[model samples]
Target: MKVSTHTCPVCGFDQLKEAPRSKSGSASFEICPACGFQFGVSDDDDGLTYDEWREDWITRGMEWSSRGIKTPRGWKPEALLKSVLKKKK
Candidate 1:
């Protein structure tokens, strides 16, 4: 009965086919196509918490971080963040 949430915890990009982490909270090592956050590498090795990366991403203008992946048409990072925050509360 554990529902897997595929939503990216960093920028609220919800199209992730598989969650970055498993149900037991293990990193999948899959890189997010939106924020380019490689789950285990960025977190375990680089020692970045989600909040820290999120702040840096915002400061960097929230640009689509994935290389060679086209930004989705009409994608709005601000709106994505808003929607995700609303769900969190």
Candidate 2:
């Protein structure tokens, strides 16, 4: 068994203590306690993991909902245009 330790990027504190291996040996990630930050380590260009992105998006959505915030009309239009372009590809 190999022990993996991750230090918080923000606070430089070693708070999270876990070793999580991804499916198909894709990547690994750890959480930080001092700043509640999470990061992923992978043998690829993108440093973020799927879990990190999902969690971040979910958290952002929850925060936005709590604040009664709505996505801007301009942003929605841009997204719709991008979606149409992607579908056409």
Candidate 3:
């Protein structure tokens, strides 16, 4: 949900709203009011074109969804973060 009103490259439409993200923490869809173009946020984060942004989004998504589903990818990232954040008792 952390998004700015940026122009959609696909539709040359500047008006965009932050659509709800999926369980994977990726934007489920974007709607262009001018052209009625719809596209997913992942379509914008490919490594070849936007590697830095992709990494940034991934980090944010992981953090935001930490309390939600434990993605099928694995629990290592969440576990690692929890361990790192855990206080010594």
The candidate that achieves the highest TM-score relative to the unseen native structure: 1
| Candidate 3: residue 12 lDDT (0-100) | 28
Which structure is stronger by TM-score: 2 or 3? 3
Q: Which prediction has more favorable TM-score, 1 or 3?
A: 1
lDDT by residue (4-55, candidate 3, tens digit) is 6654333223334654344575754654443333445344543222234334
Whichever of 1 and 3 has more lDDT, that candidate is 1
Name model 1 segments beyond 4 Å from true: 1-5
Clashing pairs in 1: none
lDDT of 2 by residue, 1-89 (tens): 96656433323333236533445644345544332334453214456643454355445542211123343333332333244335446
TM-score of 3: 0.29
The TM-score that candidate 2 achieves is 0.25
lDDT of each: 0.84, 0.39, 0.40
Candidates sorted on lDDT, descending: 1, 3, 2
**TM-score ranking, high to low:** 1, 3, 2
Compared with the true structure, model 1 gives a TM-score of: 0.85
